[model samples]
Target: MSATGHDYAITRTLDAPVEKVWAAWTDTESYGRWASAEEVVLDVRPGGAWSSVMVIPGGARIPLTGSYTEVVPNERLVMGMNVPGRDEPVLMALDLTPDGDRTKITLSQTFDRAEDRDQSEQGSNMLLDGLTRFLAAA
Candidate 1:
């Protein structure tokens, strides 16, 4: 559970090293391999920008853009995620911790309304699942 003022939070433990999991989130090519996105551009530094085009199952493409507010290598990442046609960007925080030979990842997304967070829950979990599988195969 996260007390980061987020509307939604999900946690997953990956059977991969912390450094490997960290790279999966921060590196462009690694992220593209695991993320549910058609294309990804990640500049993983504070104030750096990142963007991705999420390909929905039914061929819908949603463009997402964000800027990193905080980036602590292999530990935490905070970003402002821009929603399509929305002026205010949602805040997202990702925290990583080492657990033996594995990594524990907690992802939190803050939205204005509970409905919005509910709507995003499934996709967010799917994203983490995808990461888990990717890491397992790596």
Candidate 2:
């Protein structure tokens, strides 16, 4: 959680070029290679929709869907996450920066409640780790 206490943020640098990183994000097949999802459908544009079916521990597939609020090619993406049972949508932003040959990415999600932010932090970090591994092997 941030000092303001409503956001969960994670930053990671992948040993890959900005173009490659951006391709991996914008391509559904490339995204599925990293994200812990059984299936993924993404349309990367403002007002476009994206969804994934996550493969959880119990073998149950959890559906996560979102709409693209902002998309700036290789630099930034802002998405509104639609979690089941939540009346309010959670907002997430990804900022990508070129760091030499590597790409640094900062991903942050905002929730209405601090408890929700705290609870999602670990999982967010774990997903970033997964992305690093996926990029390394790609």
Candidate 3:
């Protein structure tokens, strides 16, 4: 937790293979299918860029942008993202573990400030829930 006061970690299991899950995260089209509420665009290689706009249930939209910091096929991904009005970027790490016929995905995000961390934890958990649902349907 940086100056602002928040810290969080979220994990979810998907009934899909690591490869399929990786594809959903790295491919723009598949990412949009699960991760995007309004829109999503991704350039998945290291140093590549990504962006998305999430529409809240009540009609507000929040935009997010980031660059890929690391990518390891179907195992891991690390990215740096910045929220609107925030001066510092947050670091996010995604770990995918193969579990027999399923995949366990863990997402960890660290913010420079505690306030942002708390806010992001809630939002990211919601997004992960959506991803779980989407993967189930897919």
Candidate that would win on lDDT: 1
lDDT by residue (90-133, candidate 3, tens digit) is 77898999998899999887666677678878878877877788
TM-score of each: 0.90, 0.89, 0.86
**Any residue pairs clashing in model 1, and if so which?**
none
Give a tens-digit lDDT track for model 2, residues 44-105: 99999999997766798888998999999889999888978988567788889999999999
Report the Cα lDDT for candidate 1.
0.86
* Higher-scoring candidate on TM-score, 2 or 3: 2
Error of 1 at 44 (Å): 0.7
- lDDT values for all models: 0.86, 0.84, 0.82
Residue ranges of candidate 1 with Cα displaced over 4 Å? 1-6
Error of 1 at 73 (Å): 0.3
Q: Which residue runs of candidate 2 sit more than 4 Å off their true CA positions?
A: 1-5
